[model samples]
Target chain A: MTETASLRRAARRYRLEFGGAMAAYALTVLGTSLWIDANPGSSARLPVALLPVIPVVLVVVAAVRFFRSQDELLRRRQVEALAFAFVGTALAVITYGFFETVGFPRLSAWWTWGTMAILWCVGTFVSSRRYG
Target chain B: MKNLLRVLRTERGWSQLDLAEQLGVSRQTVNALETERYDPSLPLAMRIARLFERPVESLFFLDEDAT
Candidate 1:
């Protein structure tokens, strides 16, 4: 297949997986919210809250599938990008922890994941361009 | 590292995609090899050499500065 064709195939698979994961997440969130609203402080609410982890796990699976689908060079580039994001996120989290002790606003745990995702995107762009 | 991937592909009248298909790799990988931005693994290099009917050393050379 041509380069464009291969890229399109990869993209198609990624989009399908991503869309499925997103749909699952949306459903889980909506279902859990409605359940909690109706039940009102029921003992099952905590366990129901954990139901969103199902979609989050699916998202992780989708990410792994996407990684495995890439060709070697692209895989290498992505690995490098993820490595950067991993280290950068760790450093950022550590710095934030120190700052929090010094009166900085205490951030939500989700911010770490969000920052890592953003860093992953930045790393992908930078690493791909460097290879090119 | 430097390689004659572009020259060999052109001589064979093969596009990067064609060569990549033959080598079971992506076109971006072939481009990276030709541009000297990435070096193929031993097996991949051997495959490239085999496809071009040349020795690996003949197709790829280490830059003096790369050493």
Candidate 2:
């Protein structure tokens, strides 16, 4: 198969895995929320809170698989993209830290992950365009 | 570094995808090589040269400015 075809197939599989993860995440969130509502002071809160991470791990695994399946050139592009995203996110977090010190409201930890994901997407697009 | 990848591929009447398939690489790799955006490894360069039935030196060359 052509590299593009292989990549597309890998992408399709990743998408399916991602979809499954998202579905599981949604269900876990719903279940946790309902359980929390029913038992506002339950001892199971800690475990419930961690349930969503199960699907997240699956998503991460799918990402690793996708990365492993890429050709060397594509892998290099991804490495560049990841480096860009890492540096960008670091700078953003540092800037946010400065803002926090100046009395800005502290954001959730998930915002960091969200920033990385956004920057990674941007980096991938930029890098691909640069190479293309 | 510079190479006549585009010229060679054109001479062979091969699309990037066709060349990539023969090279066991992605079309993007072929495109990157043609555009000089990325350099192939020695082994990959040799594979490309072999595919085109040319010496590696004939297929690729260093730019004077690059030195």
Candidate 3:
């Protein structure tokens, strides 16, 4: 096979694996949202419940594949994005801590999770803009 | 670093895609490197060297003076 053809093949394989894992996570996380909404009284519906193990497995597999065979550029880009995520998350938590230490109270763990989601999206956008 | 990736790849009758497969990168990434639109990191440089069966310094140069 020609060089170009082979490269396309590799890229297609990586995309399939990465995209499939992402779709699985999305479906599982959104699907389980209902359980939490329906049974607020039960800790069984928490986001980190045992029911979500499937997505975790999918993520782990995808992660292994991506790390083992991904392009150097894309790998570096992912690492940069992750660094941005950590910085963003840490900044949010520090701000929350300061507010609580003063007279201002904060929301519960759910709110923290919600904030994390928001910050993650923003971090991805910002990091991609700056680096990717 | 500047590299003779374009020359060596062409001499071997290898397109950017072929090198991309060996390197596990997109053809676009290979094109980018060849056109000097992007630069490859050390690990990638080493991979290319290994694939081409050339010394790292032979394929990639630190500066114009290295030649």
* Off by more than 4 A, model 2: A1-3, B65-67
Q: Under CAPRI classification, how is model 3 graded?
A: acceptable
Candidate 1 lDDT, tens digit per residue, A11-34? Answer: 798899889999999999999999
lDDT order of candidates, top first: 2, 1, 3
Which regions of candidate 3 deviate over 4 angstroms?
A: A1-50, A103-105, A108-132, B7-14, B35-47, B50-54, B64-67
lDDT of 2 by residue, A1-132 (tens): 445677678889999998999999999999988888899888988898889999989989998998998878889889999999999999999999999998999999999999999999999999899888
TM-score: which candidate is best? 1
Model 3 is docked with a DockQ of: 0.37
**lDDT (CA) per prediction:** 0.88, 0.90, 0.71
Task: Give per-residue CA lDDT, model 3, range A1-132, as digits (tens).
Answer: 433554455557767876787787787777787767777788665544555677667767866765655566556655666676677777888888898888887777777657766765676676445442
TM-score of the second chain of model 3 compared to its true counterpart: 0.86
Comparing 1 and 2 by lDDT, which wins?
Answer: 2
Residue B31 lDDT in model 2? 88
Clashing pairs in 3: A3-B17, A3-B18, A4-B17, A4-B18
Deviation in angstroms for B29 in model 2? Answer: 1.6
Error of 2 at B41 (Å): 2.0
